[model samples]
Target: MDFSHWLLLFCTLLAFYNLGIIWFGQIVVYPLFAKVGAEEYITYHTFYSSQIPLPVILPGFAHFLLPIALIFYRPEPVSLGLALANAACGLLSLVVTVALEIPRHNRLEKGGKQEDVIRELIRYNWPRTFSIMGSAFLTLMMLMQAFSPTI
Candidate 1:
């Protein structure tokens, strides 16, 4: 019914959506990169990187920003501690994506058939994935805490 409530709901939904994407990307998508033949891998990677679905891209960006927003806005159900933890996870995810994964992806785009990069991508993705999943859990907990009848 208010700005804080909306912020909490948006953050919760985005984090949950991101967690799903992370799990699917980790388990299904990233592993399959190795299967693509060397000749086609670069083309596929280029297309994949270029053509990220809007639904994925927008919310993905929001997931990165929403926690920071939550930290400043602090809804009734959302404690400062929870917001800080969520922000930490969001920041970690952003760092991992920009610093680690993006470079590795860039390398793969140029260095075709780099199995090492692919391996590294998969290996390094777990932290980002876990952080997203953790954010989702934290958001859900905040919601429960918000909605639960007061003692």
Candidate 2:
């Protein structure tokens, strides 16, 4: 329909897609990498260092922008609340990424003493994972509001 509508749909789709990435990364990918021993661990770290930032940066930026679009578009109050909640989740994701994840990733890439890096990665990753889940929830709520009867 309009920009806000399109933005909501896009945000919903992307958030869900991002959720899939986080889920797979946490459940399958990271665990697999973690089990591969030190050399493979280094390789996994390097690969993740090079590739993960792409997914993190763009979708992160989009996640931030979409909520602002919804706010600007001034949707219904229910829709606005849903959008704000979604945006807040994105903001939390950004905070966790900046405050925790990226720093750990940087340390992993630097090839230094990683005595606590894995532990920290495991710790910090959970909040980011939960934030994605929260975003998915909010996005679904927004979609419901977008489609549901205005009562």
Candidate 3:
């Protein structure tokens, strides 16, 4: 398939993969840690704080690449629109990750107050969640356009 098509498919898979991170963090990982005593929670928090940068930086770089690729490919209107929308959502997620989440993670890493860290984490995570869902929706729309007889 064309580059636009390939980028769309790549984004769809990436968004779905991110959804797994969201689900696992929200449902399994956080809750388990949250249930532990405060000391344990703090320790867990500190560990994760150190680890967070790797995930964020890698995905942020990938987010940059995807949009550039979509723009370069220059698909037809319907496909292009869908790809652009998906790219926009990915950009939004990247912004939220860099602007909001990374700072919080950095603070936590530095030995900032736990309450503040947790609060920021909770606040910032929703946008990432929504962006992933938006990417999925846009991908579905693109697929329909791609396979539709009229298109």
Pick by TM-score: 2 or 3, better one: 2
Between candidates 1 and 3, which one is better according to TM-score? Answer: 1
- Model 2 clash pairs are none
Return the lDDT, model 1, position 57: 68
lDDT, candidate 1, 6-37, per-residue tens: 88888898898898888999999899999999
Ranking of predictions according to lDDT: 1, 2, 3
Best by TM-score: 1
Q: List per-candidate RMSD values in Å.
A: 1.3, 2.5, 3.2
Prediction-by-prediction clash tally: 0, 0, 0
Better of 2 and 3 by lDDT: 2
Residue-wise C-alpha lDDT for candidate 3, range 31-126, written one tens digit per residue: 454355665655766776568556644654575357546655644545666677778887888788779877876665565447756656776778
Off by over 4 Å in 2: 40-43, 53-56, 112-115, 149-151
Which consecutive 10 residues in model 3 have the weakest lDDT in total? Answer: 30-39
Q: Which lDDT value does model 2 have at 51?
A: 84
Error of 3 at 150 (Å): 4.9
